[model samples]
Target: MALRTGPAHAENDPATPSQRQIYSQSIAEHYDYRFGANQPFLPSLATTDTGEFINSKAFPTAKYCGHCHQEAHAEWRQSAHANSFRTPWYTRNVNLLMAEKGIEYARHCEGCHNPTALVSGAMTKGSTINRKFDEDGVTCSVCHAIQKVDTRGTGSYVLAQPAVLVDEHDQPIYGEVSDKEILTHLDRHSKAVMKDFYRTSEYCSACHKAALPRQLNDYKWQRAIFLYDEWQLSSFAKQSPLPFYTKDSVSTCQTCHMAREPLGAIPDYGAKDGKLASHRWLGANTIMAKFYNYDVQMEKTVAFLKNNVFNVDIFGLEKNGSRMIAPLGTEPVSIAPGDILTASIVIQNKGIAHSHVPEQRDMYESWVEFEVTDSTGRVLTHSGTIEPNGDLDPRAHSFTNRLVNIKGEINDLHQVWNNRVVAYNNTISSGRSQIVRYQFKVPTDARGPITVTAKVNYRRFDQHFMDFAMGKDHYPMPVVDMSSRTRTFSLGENPATPPDPQDNPLWMRWNNYGIAMLDAQQYSESVHAFEQVARLRPDYPDAFTNIAIANFSWQRYDDSRTSLTRALKLSPHNARALYYLALVERNQGNLDAAIADLREVIAQFPRSRDAHRELGFSFYQQRKYNEARAEYETLQTIDPDDLAAHYILSIVYRRLGMADKASHEAAMFADQKDDPTASTYALDFLRKHPEVASESVVWHTHSDLEAAPSHGSNAPAQ
Candidate 1:
């Protein structure tokens, strides 16, 4: 439905019907005269009847929850989810990415991943969230208060007033239907109507999805994180009812992750009267469980995921113990110095329950490390390495993706440098594939087998980072080797090679490219260059995709999709293509077609994220909020603090119209105004967005309208 529009001051104008505006204006007036809209009707902090934590105190802390829920607490402590704010890894990378970009770009990541620390007023110049509350990460308050989810993948969850139960004397009281523990604090917990929208997948879309750059490629929607979407296209999304899969029996995320535990009988360990869902909330981060020495918790999480979700297929071993194929892609092919050598790597998001690399975490670093050397082992070429002090070599290629930061009007920076998240996210989606191409001159004097090695290296924290943030001894903060692969090229007795002229076609068709361009050595220059080509061939699908891809590299998913969709329509089923029509359908919040496309992709290319992420998202939109959250949450296990997963989950809360959730997510994007790369996403979004008439406006006291309520003349007699 189209939104109504009128003068900003039309409070009682019968021409328009939305009462929200009038309500907002009234609330705004109350704000000016009193505490205003910001006043949260929290239960009195001084109240004493709320249940006591394991330790009784006036104001119990999160630590109190740990006593009764020892297992959950311990797991949380080791997981990034627990250390959202104080994780040394996030701290160091956040500082680095922001330093290189700007502060405005960094906050987008901080919103969900480190919300407690960010909102506690901890983040600022030369300061990080390393305190008590911040250390607790996303505490109970963060989730319990989530009343709504936006679901459009914009990360627009809404925060709501505390649900309180009142007493006969009109005193405030609060109760937990989920827990038996009572608190000392009390508040009015009237049953507020929670819209079923909270259950839908659209709720996740609000934040998980990102918009593309309008300046570079025109505003388009790119599918950045697609966990929910991925599941929608999977067998899990289908109902077998009376068929092979079973009638009305469809697999849901909650079915596996949040399954209720059966009650059992015991003396001291007697189970609750009803079934209780496991709150361990575990996923793929077993390493974290190991880090805090929380072996039991880690083992539980690992066992749960390995037993429930997909299996891992590790490869890349050489027959003669010499070299292996690339860890992620297909076998490597030989090429001359000037040849545009091609290598296809298939880094499956195997273990993750949903999409891989869900969201933007400053410390979430994943890349293919490539080293080319002669048989003697002397390094001839290397990429994805950090220098001694802290800086990445200007010449080396990097696998770590980046977001855009558009803080200033004229100047734009990558999200790492600036705090703004204008648009553009470059992370591999679940069940998705990204192909990398590197062209180098085969040396004229090259002889024998020229070996090339590629490792899917992942690190929790950058090496030089800890010392830069928390001081020196924080050295060697573990960098885990998630996976690796390799291949050898026969450079046999090659004659002197001549320099090959550069082909601008790859640069000309940026839209066809995805993650590859995100790490392009000439990202900034290529952005402008591709834009010109797009302008020259405005109707060309490839041209649009090229420009769109550039915007996607900068984290502008919204804009990227527009062009990609057009490309798909113009040329369907192009194997070497980026976005499939079905994938676009799922991203646009379409379910059925997304399923079809995903199935088709699997039939054609067995390993694909297009189907999985889209399927998951579609299922989420289908009022399966818990299921959706589970899928996205599962992705985070593989890639901790994945921005895409968190963002999507936040949006699910927003679409449900949950106020607290919306506030949390809005905070993430609120500071985007200061980022250059982020500007493109927000600006294009607002411009193309059907304008929402002002929700709060002042109305002049003109003449009073006749009151018609209880009067025979259709007007109330005054």
Candidate 2:
């Protein structure tokens, strides 16, 4: 029988059908649940506090939680948590996996997706025990039961089943506590679930950063999902000072998703000042919410997406005659008929603090939808328009990935098992930017003063996936306009937009554009863009550093040094300026000065991976093998996957008479390096498919723009 510690509330959900009691060891009965060679879940296949399989029934369900947290539970029940496994799309995917690879393979997803079924051993072969926890999905106590976690991810968490808090004798105090007992000793209930680590981003990393290991793919390691890893790579990680924006603090996962709200009708354990962290886990899951008729959740989800989380700015126009660049829609700029225009649009991932889109990029759709029309509303050029069949136009520039298998065929079924290569991925990193230069000719007969409107739009799922799952006749999902900008160009003069608090400052907008150009490796254009930023805000030290970074990449060693000198004058101890000064000195062969600057950078920012890398390289240049080895090793400790650290360590180890360490470093370097032949895979597919290629060329032009005239043709080490 089900454990009836609490008084039943009316009747339980029909989906959670009553069934034969599932004893701890009854599932599998012989051995723990397994997946090929990788036991994806907990080491013990879920465990008691004593390290044995605990009954899934022991974990309190949402209904039990609703006895006290009525409002919170009601909110959670309507969230993605309650429906994670019950959702039709997720159900289809898991069912497909079971049919194709068997239940054992489902363990990989269940570790985070459906832990109750995972820990209960229901994922094993022929385990017919119906589980209440299965319907609960990620229930109240599932998260509360977590005792420890490893931030390396892939559901690297340990759950203690005898309740989180223990008794005086270090024994489980929570296996069968009655509702009266729990209510009387409410302190135990709070301690049972609350831990300091629960507030950390690393705690969320346990499940957010998932990878496809060799055991599952029967091939080399592949990045499957890395939301946490992307966060680490962003400015939010606070490990580097090279980001375009100033980052003052580390970002925890709960910062945005769990924003606190005032207490409602139900009481909460952790409520302070009548406010508590929300359990709704607000995110981009409109597809699930809309399909289930969750109107509140759907509205909240849409509002969250539209809350200035992204920025789309139409910045400059590249004039056809004389190739002059003018700030688009500015009062000083003029537009005329018979003129060819290349308008520059900048997209900024302002709020996400991570990748614009994190996982399985091709599945969820986000793109820049643009249209150029005359004042009379006559369309000139339209891209990213919706088709009659609910699909986006083929020519749209999307924040997605084009991945293919060995045969160069695109996989649309969210099938990671079939993925082989990534042709192109267009996700903007946190506090970063991507530039789109859209070119079109103004027709001689066109009306004057045209309007150029561009919007960053989003959809929860691709039309292809929706159609496959629900058939073509189902209602189409909502298409949200995340961020947008509209500009008007007059025949004689274009007016600039009036200043608004919500809009980015003119200087910062130019700086953002320069940063994007720098990332795109358009050194000359980046230098020009940074020059405008410096002209606009010379007092800002970051502007000078931006100029220096562009110059350094352009191999203008003297110019880089000049910019860094100006930056240092504005702020004598700026780490970014100092770091670039060292790079300029090193490249100019001023070894002693470079070392001194690098040491200062290391002193200020100890975790600066780039500082460590450059310092190691400087030591190696001076034949200081021992010092180089130590710096490289420290760099390795900071980021184990750093290919530069591995490669240099390989050389430095042999120089220091450590042959085995040298060999290991060399192998690690090779293992972490990108596949050189990977580009050919994308190129081959694009060649065979002309439509995709025509659209892709513009999107992939980030790395191929003509370099502006600079110091040297050969690029310096970035």
Candidate 3:
């Protein structure tokens, strides 16, 4: 298959002179007011002092910087960031946005993908852009000159003037003058450009962590991507004094992606240094590189994908027992004829900062291919195979999220503007694992030995998506094998003695069973398992907490109270236990108690958005409009796109006689409301569409281990 190679059609034309004049006039008119007034949503281009003019002598092209940094520049030239704006896929989508919403609306995308056009006042409808900057995409100076990162997230970086020195004519000087120049000169430039903030994950969050506001998507405020937040919760983001650090201490976004390489001597930077980091920013993006015929980058991306960041294992087998299903796997055991075999395949996200498949999940495909065969190599059962028509096996275990629009239909491709709900999300989180069980009946006349093979495969784009994106273009998107495991078992052997439940630490066995039950939503069974944990470890608060949660989920309010009481007795001020107790109280009509408990939770954890919303709702129920309005306003600050908050605020403001505010809130609520037919959980949707559910596994975070107690007696109770 030959890859398509050409400059994006959008880049072929420059902005018309009339459009440029209109943009220049608009910027001149709005610059001072927008920047000086501190309008939060406005771009940094509103500040005239930043000197973003491409024609300016101080602003050098990326090629100018490449003169001295040859190796880094060469590597970057092949990276996706280099071709970000010029890619055919990007141009196709962006042009569609322009045609549908006009150039003014298209600026939303240009803010990140074509910052140069945006900052130079060339992003208006019909305006021509600087071809040089558009091709550069995220250039070296664009990233290096970032002065500050806004905690608000979503491409909130402040651009400062470039660090390079200028000659008498104010033209920027590039590279070293000689082998030995004053260290201060280079140090000044480095200090201005490479601030310490650039080394942190927060720097990447500026663009990587994005969300669509209600105004932009014409839907409720939705978090479009969350790679940065995912990393923050993982072990990789921990610094000193934080307990979740990996064995090697702290690791930043730069650590794995821009790993240091030994480069030969380059003027003032030192000789043959291994501390020089590569600018390739290699990731799982081989498709775009292949489209552009960037062989070097394509090879590096493939290598990165297969670098053992994930592990797949056939952990155990399950069968019918006195218990609904008992785990049977310490070692390989015999399987008799007519017996049902339930094999559990565990896929662990080991090293990735976010979920195994991070951003643009709708475009990619990751699945577990499982096969079982006899000695003669005759296939017994096969899953995750691709059909000639490019459809995945209907019963395969796939790690992909199914996004649906307001009409409750699949988005199909990267039609992100139409997305309303994540119908199903099965991506495994960092340092987490998902267990998928496949059951098959052993044939009565089966051969002696049976072999099981499981492989985790990843493809850059799903076939349907590729076909839609590249019409009449036949490029083979390679399916890279991320991880695999094999296990063989013989028939006619005696069933091994089931491991004594007491042999291992009682907590471990019960905890495992409890978690498995929770994952399957077997609340009653999970409660029983957790009860065993509580009996074995009386002082452990987590087990009791788990019991309470199970009972709460099961809607046994009185029973939930009993377990929550015990959990609170073991550890006073347990946030989770208190939160659930409040839920039980609210459900049982103990509104005052619920309000008090929720307030306490908020006091302890001010960032608890749930607590604030619950308390706000409680106030609204009691007609305390002022208190409810205050709480909802705080929620708006915390999460501007909170659907429930906007809905309630509309009512609260109306009751308070603030007609304008109420009207504004009502408009936002209308835009953000969930589809009336949308199901809260994918499992609910799957219940009706069993065919699709059978092939996919949706791994929601299980809360059983949230408050798991420490082993030692001296350890503090959660």
Candidate 4:
């Protein structure tokens, strides 16, 4: 096929009996923007600047690019990107959305999944356009043609016109040229498609992040999956002090997903120094790869899942009737058959740059499977097991989300149109740890020795959803064990866990326990745990910082300051220490000192949400309205759903005599506010299932045991 100079010829044009652009018409009518089709690409479909549809024939196919970029093409062929649109699984999801709520609603999905179809008007009403591009599914041109990126997600890329060359007037030249002609204008070709931003995380954010808008669901704005923003605020971006594993530089999306690999013999046009960025965007899509029999990709995806992105550590046990904040596996211990215990497991999001199984928490299965057994092979108790019908044990501790509709119904399906609020979320953010306390009786008559096992597991999709999408012929979706730990309880006496090669250093293990204790609000135990970290790693600064965090949270401001001083003595420029020091100063009523330390912290990390939030509150306390407004405005851009910013900004607006702005901000504050009734939803579930509730009280914490989840428990400075 030659290079296309214009729109491809219409293929079997279909006539519509009714001229009504909606249900009376075709899919083309689905594209719209109730908020006006210009800003925030979700509703806009990210069409060309003029908001005009380009014909499908305008863009070249992957095969044309594969002729030269063979290695890259081959790698991409097995990737989730290539199968984004055409896969039977994806087709079923979008097809239903189109049917249930008019085709226009599906534009929310097709914008990211099948941009070629979207920008080319293939998704709208009775349209005659070359549909061949649909097979390419996020083809080579879709990424390379990106001219600009709007990091605020939901298909936020700006695409340039399709062209292989440009005229002297800087106009796009769309016709295909022969290899000999392209070799003569290789520089022009690079200029035509390649962009520096393509190598950036922001570029990935264009499609990776998503949100629900009023235009689609007839509701207020609500965030959907926000992998990009989540990463930006994690240790990966070096933008916060929340991480346990700290680094000096920002690790972009390409750093992990599109790892560079040797191209071997194939000539890859995009190769740099004997390596090309692997196009097999390794993700949690083992199901799709197996369905398509792309074994190599499937294997790689599984390997990625098990490649130490997260770790599961069965730390300790809490004897029932005698509650102890997981003191960790330190020193020898004793256990008896008649005793009931609560097993403590710590799940650390160690190396992942974003949340584990990010962006698909609502669909993917990620959970902690806990089991206990006796020497006689008698099953004591198991929380996470597959039922005969393929459903997971409903009470399993899962690292997933539950987005609810206005009526409080759970939308397990990936229906973007139905999302209203995050009713439940337990996904561990990067460099964070989650604690799962499972309590069970030891069985008085059971065998002496008890073996306990816990694992972090991943499945591409649950049985129910897969069955719904695939219909009668249910294809098997394999489960991947991401991380696991096993411990044994002896007859009368049990030694601490024997050191393992895979375990974190003893000091770090103690620190992990301390972090978990802080999350559970066991301040004395948390402080004791951090003190152990200090004793083991006296040279490490974070040990002291950890102690300070516990003290600060416990309201021992003087003791907190003492630890911070020691931490600073070890590392003068420790940002985490300095950030915590600021918190102490603010708590002690030293506003000026607190402001200085916060300013210094902000200088090192301009994107620090905590710094901006605290600074804004400080200024508001000093009654410096202008300065406070600037900080709050900056905070709003960093985290749009911040409750404090919305509430305080509403007051700031009124103080500035902007009554209209104040009134509007008040509504956002209410909208973004956490649903007090959401607590009742979990209570209702517990009431219905007293059997599960009787095990023990469960505490689910999101922060890395930070003193404050976001802002400190202290209300924003009056």
Candidate 5:
């Protein structure tokens, strides 16, 4: 449930006080309020002790912050966050949203990018927006003012009232007065900067994870950004009982971005031995730094992108009879002319906490550029070429997620509200790798020493998004070469037969390729890749389990059952295998078998959420309302914010004639039903003005409601 700090009001009321007044009151009343659960909610604005909402003007500028924090301020001034709201690219989109859906709807975008404008009441309809302080995007005061944070991502934070010293006349002191005055009121500065929340990933998640309100998307639930959740599930920040957990090596948001550095101007209170965290907040966004002409920052960003966080290698080559693929080695390979060679470019996400291109993947572009040439500089074959019109080659392999609207058309624009289907998602997750294979005939008269080069390139925004955002005034987005590998092959006689797969050291390479295929939702291709492993090592239980998973995803129930049977026969107590087998049994209408398998899974892995949920569902199917209620109650205890559990419990309680319990569960369901940020009022305006969708070149993808079931919690990981 979204906690409001302001006075209680009717749900349907529209003419309440201005957002500024509400925000001020909320902060004043709930200054000490802490989040009860990690549920997503909108953050309220910060306020002064007098119940006055803090605006951009209330905060000191970056220059003022530099007085005692020179190096940090200097680094921040060159960061993308400093110029976030003032950037031409950003303003263009914000203005477009404002014009199409009114200023009220645009608040969703401003909530993160231009919080100053949002909190100051400048974004209200017909209000005069003050751009004076817009340049100070995400300033020092805005971040330091946060008091409490909800575990939920997407700006679920509460701001504390600023601790300001008053003059003799009772007026607030605004800026730097004097060193002597600062020394006299040192406690106020200490209170502002001493919050432990500053070092937490939850603080960063406030803006990093955003979702489209159900009203905006015209769907019950729609997630737009997932960086926070991705990080939570990663080895760096594992909170759940996942199979992959690295206890010895743990990292936080501050670890990589805020490395320790010597302070240029030591603060009187916070500095420890003249060392402080570097405030560069460096990310893979060199284009913006280059556009802003921050030469030093651009250099640093470019260096970070090319630092081998992601690696690209020519894994292997496939031909008529056999394929020779392995991680890149010093050995040179010999290929014959006129032979059809299929080269595999393996792109691995090695160090990123989430997917390679983490957030706003629809607009951002990450793809592989493969090129093969001869010693004479003659281009033999090339993929991922940039067209004359600034478009990428259609055949190029892209690591992006494509959304489909209700009409089953692609939504090229970044308006995620209309998304219904994740038609394709090829982004590589952390510790995963993708294999893109290209088949081309080696020319009969081809010269010796054919060089193959594969590069993984990243762009902040793709050509299609830029075309819509900037139209004819499009500026070329810089493409960073993330990682690359070059391999040269000399013409020679091929080995009669490729090395045996069992004897080869690259078995894991093939297994990783299969997992990549699974991640991409290419079930058939994944099965084929896993079959190679099954053939090599028939006794390998994991290979059969993988095959079963692919079959299960494809809805081939009999095939899945057969594969699972083989897997269970090999390793009877394999929890993962048992979990999927239970799912297959449930889908096949074998309730008893499903329940039995789920019980076994629970006994093996006590904290299996999926097993518990499935067991409860099976009991509900059998009309055992009391048993269903008990299982759902356990689920509620495990995940307090489990909406599905609450919903099911509501029904079960009602069925059992427990009116009070039913009402309680129903209320919890109602509170969390719709996201606070999803505006029904704004949606009504959008429905009346359907032309907005037509005018935008971004709405290219049409959605198919029944395309495929979403890869939700029940879905198995690759």
Candidate 6:
């Protein structure tokens, strides 16, 4: 059975102490948190708390690694992950952001860029470390410290404590993480189970997606985070049976970027036929990497990106510029009469890592441009192109996102400084293919041959949006065309045989294109795209439901209502659409209607925290304390670590005249223990704002750690 309560904190909850810590300390007598319970069997090392006797030298430093693994090391030296902290491009931008938002905000960027130095107590004002931590970019320790990975889209991880030891059973163990050979001298120490989540997509997401405190949402930092959520809403997730797409789909990040290589030494762990994961860690960002003189890594990254990309399949085109790749509104291949002629396109994720447009977790991009043409190469319908001002054509089917600035201005230039992406559509994950469909009436005067040309395009940033953000002249963004395909559809005596829905190219394009429109905030365009989706896949409730949301957001109230009705008629228990319907009704001033919809939403998705939270807020507005409290309490059970929920619960308790309950909830914040980096931030923030120290609970000193009686406890390092 699942545990009915929350995780026990060793120092915070005095009633119970960590058993793992106590047991290990008793066995070792002079137990050290850095080493395992049993010290490694090393002849040159002394143990216990006060004594250390390791004089033998072993292992190679990064310089020595360059001696043998020179090629690999050279590639790593220039990547953004390497110079993340000190690159001039980042330096100027970071400094600008710091001057505007203060030091605490800047830590968000530095956290990922220079994690080692940031963690090692560098990064103070007027600091003197340049290029020191930039040697390896993402060094060996950064990845190794990944103790746990959370699979949820929220992207949370547990970092491992740094400790290196040699074999304790075979030799005396000393605590120090210096060499790979030292691993053999260490005894395995297991604590809380380290699940596979650590190695999955969620692991990459922790730093990839970020959010701002509620107070800072106005600054638009929330848009900077949300890459993981983008993928979750993609067709990849819709069609994926497993957590990630399997072979029929393209391989994911683990399959390509971190592909296993032959292990020459440690075969049992990951060496299969002498193969283990290559540590090259290459991806996009070629220009920036090369700018920093890290061409080797950039070359590898460019090669990887160039080789692995989506594959396209085309059927045939019609002379009137409309192509009939398959029959619309049917699955598999069918010969139904009166079916609207459809063009089908099959897009397969062949080699890209994670998403097709990787690292676009923030900038909202990834699109395919299509131009149906005559034999003379005359233009037909075009979607996704750069306008004169260098922003994406608003009406085109393209990857979309909102652009906002610090001053609440909309920026269309999509430049760096002014570019604050409010949304995006780059959700295509590795190893997944989405079929798209486009329908056009066959003109009786159609010519014999038709050509459909498609191109996969990208832009570094939307310059127009950027201009709005920074209110200054900006540089043009670099554009890259990834892949393209063309095929001639020959007119036949009878309408072309309808291709299977699974193999439909039009649907494939539409599916991916719809994602782009949604990302770009072309709500009406997305709804129009979904209309085709609904027409093609009428049985799929999500197609209609999503369209309803698009319509609602665009303020087409009645149309949105009708679409929701149709969706419910198709799948009466679609909790998602029902919730959307409720939202629409609430926004339309039909409180009762919204309540009815919420009731249905609750019935279908009982454990939905979003539904509960929204409904609780609704009830609380009506002074329904009991109802609001019940919902909030339920939410706490569903997500106990949610400090926001606890804070809200405190308010509810106060409203109910439960002072003790409110005090307890408020105290949770008072006793908050800052993480290493966070403590440093608190110290600095308090120094600047002494008044905050008095008003808010602050924990940021050595005395704070010492006051915790359990500080010296010896817990197993996992």
Q: Enumerate residue pairs that collide in model 4.
A: 27-123, 27-124, 27-125, 28-124, 28-125, 29-124, 29-125, 30-104
- Please give, for residues 1-718, the per-residue lDDT of candidate 4 as tens digits: 2232232212221111121122222333554433454532346336565445555555777888887789999888888888889887789888877788766666778788988777766665555666777777988877877777776677877775466665455555563445555566677778777778888888898788876656677755666778877888888888887566687777889998999988778798789889998899998887888888888888888888888887777777767557553434555667787786777788888888888767546778787877777898777777666665776666677777665555555566777577655545667777777788777777788886888888888888877788878885344678788888887778687766557766677887778878877876788978998998899889989888889999999999999999999999999977889889988998889989888888888888888888899999999998888888999889877766677988998999999999998998899888756556655655554455554443224363111111112211111100
- Tens digits of per-residue lDDT for model 6 on 655-711? 999999998877654333222332343344434544224212211111110111212
Question: In model 3, where is the ten-residue run with the lowest total lDDT?
Answer: 709-718
* Local accuracy of candidate 3 as per-residue lDDT tens digits, 101-193: 556555567667866666665655444444567788888777876667743455577764454533334333332222122243555445445
Candidate that scores best on lDDT: 4
> Root-mean-square deviation of each candidate, in angstroms?
21.5, 7.6, 10.5, 8.0, 10.7, 16.9
Worst-scoring 10-residue span by lDDT in model 4: 709-718
Could you tell me how far off, in angstroms, the CA of residue 131 lies in candidate 2 after the best superposition? 3.8
When sorted by lDDT, best at the front, the candidate numbers are 4, 2, 3, 5, 6, 1
Q: Residues 1-718, candidate 5, lDDT per residue (tens digit)?
A: 2122132223322212344356555443433222112211123222223334454445556676677666778788888778778876678766765566556556566667766665555655445445687888877766766666554444556654332333444333443344455456566455444578788777787777766654344455555666766776566764422322233566778887787767664352345677878677888776678667888787777777777677665767766547554444423456788877777666768677778676446778778877777666666677766665667654467777666555555667766556665555667787667777776667887897788888888777777777766666345777777777787777884333443332223555556666667766778867887887788778888788888888988889899989989988998877767878888998988989988887887786564566677788899999999888878877664444467887888899999999999999887777557545434433443354453332222112111111111122011100
Clashes of each: 165, 0, 5, 8, 13, 67
* C-alpha lDDT of candidate 1 relative to the true structure: 0.41
What are the models' TM-scores? 0.44, 0.86, 0.73, 0.86, 0.72, 0.53
State the lDDT at 380 in candidate 5: 69
- Which of the two candidates, 2 or 5, achieves a greater TM-score against the reference? 2
Which sections of candidate 5 miss by over 4 Å? 1-55, 164-188, 215-220, 240-247, 262-274, 321-334, 404-413, 417-422, 467-474, 494-507, 520-718
True-structure lDDT of candidate 2? 0.72
Residue 456 alpha-carbon offset, candidate 1, angstroms: 1.6
Two-way TM-score contest, 1 vs 2, winner? 2
